[model samples]
Target: MKTQKLKFTFLVFIFSFSNLFSQYTEIINSNNPGFSESPYSVGSGVYQFESSFFLKNLSTNTPTSLDNSWGVDLAFRTSFFLERLEFDAALTFQRDRLLGNFTNAYTINSGLSKIMVGAKYLIFESTYKDKSKEIRSWKRRFAFDTKRLIPSIAVFAGVNTDFVSDVYKTNTVSPRIGILLQNELSNYFNVITNFFYDFIGTNFSEYQLTITGTYNFNDRWSWFLENQTIFQQNQTNTSFAGGLAFLFNKDLQINTSARFLREAGNNGSYITLGLSYRINRHVDSYKLLDENGNEIIDTPINRYNNKRKGFFNRIFSIFKKKNKGNKTRNRGKRKRNN
Candidate 1:
């Protein structure tokens, strides 16, 4: 009787372990092509600001704790005129608030926070550069190059620090490898996708895929869908967002988006207002490195550190092209008022 009981206990343990990890099956992202559609490549300059929020529905069976978190991201990049060489920096800040009908309530000052920085370079080039202009905006003709394999790939590694409480904290340097592909199936639509995987010590690895599609019906009106999934620790949550993008002119894009998130223990959803703007920057070649690097000065876009470049590059580039057309101006018919 004793021997039979011991065997039964061992079998129960194995089954439970297998059941917990079965949700690790991978998901391939389809909307990533939309995100990678802009042409601000390695040596070019680019800037973006984004904010997102995550809300959770707490469990009912027992006393549970959950958090609603908000985060902001600031990123800059420069391409070295080489198109395949560049450097970039992305900083993120996240704060969360927790509440429940329990004795211990959670607060933003002591929840969870994180920040990260890294670099990427190009290793391969695709012939997907032949693309059409957006219906209304001439400024974004080759906004995002569409290709399935961006092979001239780069590597990135960075340090992450998280604040959980005053007395306890976790700090580690984590590395990530990323691949992006963009595709154009026809004149009316474009697709883009980006895949990234992060390893955090013994914690379960995180895999995220972002996919989006941009459909242009005319010069002023466009439609888009954004899809994302966060896979970790034997669970996967997915969300879908759809929005209408209004392109008023070259300098601005006003977009409103509705979002939804679904997972095993929680369901989340939110609506957001998104604005994307472009401030043109013209710069020289790239060769400036931050504190830590092997080839630190990687891209043309990230080197806005010099105020001199920020002021003169834009003013000079706009008129420089016109100077080349001076001969054409001289040859064209002109009636003198003399």
Candidate 2:
């Protein structure tokens, strides 16, 4: 009986712990060394930064030009007010040399190329079953959960400004919108997809699609493969990249990746090195529970003064009540016998 009671208490603790941290994680969740964004947000009160530097080379046959460039891309992300919402800003700076094929003349230019600010809100999230409650068969405990197929969905809205150098400015401000989706196939594998319409109502409008797959080798090491495609009025471009990431600690990570690009009469490639770091200040809210493992609704008067009951305290209180009832029944029996 004691063993059974202990097991029951353990299960209740697990359930309560999971509920408390549905959105927050002990480790920082970052999107780095890849172009695609994640559907999930950094938890509330988290400020994260991800940055990368890369060198790219492209040659175009139609334009008869050779481009060699290096750039740094930086993103800032944070969540506040709501756990499902996140705001982010991105900036890119690049220096490039453009060579004319006919005259063999080359010129170099450098400055900020892009600036964007955006917000993402998770619209739908799917939950999985708790397999720990199953006890009859080992096979049932280890079987796949079908509910993993339904992906979590999010929406993004942002504005792009042309506060850039003359060599790379469009002179127009436009709105960008996207849908982000993610499927958690298993404990170790995840897939993410994003669709975006960029530069709305502008001369350089385009559509983009990105698909990425990530696999975790262990707690500290992981790998990702991604493909991004861009479609414009006159041409289409596609790129494929693969990367590896290592988690140095709970709040820091480093990564490296290489990409191959293809377009109509154009080809290019780039290599990137990046890192992600975060400042975590999240605090879990307090919850009160009864002996039966049901939550006690909080009243405004006592909500601020009540403290959460610990595990041992709950167990002791339950057993103490049972003991008192047993003693009362024994006393009544003795009185009847006399």
Candidate 3:
């Protein structure tokens, strides 16, 4: 009888603890589960910085007593454009820290939160002029840029090295491909669908999909909504986020938002604030200014813009010339004037 009772007790303990067995949870949540925000939409040759504190890993079903582990990400985005073609790269530095129970917390550091480089191509662009001309009103313009709907689809593929924690089972280089589909439904609103799939699979294959939207109340103020669902071959969670976006100026933006997460019978909420500077890689900022201690590239806007103009002007000149009604006369006038 004693032995049988002991075995029964052990089985009970295992059953109760099994729900707490979580493999891993996403360390980052600034954008949708699958997609990251663009530096262009945020600003131009800028650094993107995000800091977050997570109450729980939400990896499993353990109930948290209170405030817990946290994470941070610092990143940069730079781009050069030639006519309608844009070449951009995003580099991110990541750190994630995990703390055991707050009372007796022992910090366990895992693989790099994020170490990845992504290349992007802009498939569509709409100008302030086009947007303003159509919307017509400083008030409307203040509400937002009279921009064109990208009605665009862009592709991104990158290799990331995640220094997974020794505590967890995953250890590998994660390669991923993503599709960003964006459309401006109106002068004040835009919707985007982010789809991403990781080639490398954890115990469960990794898949994420998010539907996000931004509504501009004015050029400087906007409302943003995001719904992201993350699925592993074995487990899954659905998260929702909403927040306000403030454009401080033409080149800088501060995005402050809130995120709410739900997993099985567990639920939690938190706030996030992000700042970014956009980089237009037209000029040689290396010569004009010194690099930030951690920056991968150095360059400024106006010069970079001009450099891109020269390149695109060459590649797309044929189409540009055809659009110019007085091309021959303009050429002759320039020649004669010179």
For candidate 3, the TM-score is 0.55
**Candidate 1 on 72-96: residue-level lDDT in tens?**
4344544444544444554545555
Clashing residue pairs in candidate 2 are: none
Local accuracy of candidate 2 as per-residue lDDT tens digits, 167-190 = 878878999999999999888999
RMSD of 2: 12.3
Worst 10 residues of 2 by lDDT: 321-330
Candidate 2 accuracy as lDDT:
0.86
lDDT of each: 0.51, 0.86, 0.52
As for lDDT, the candidate ahead, 2 or 3, is 2
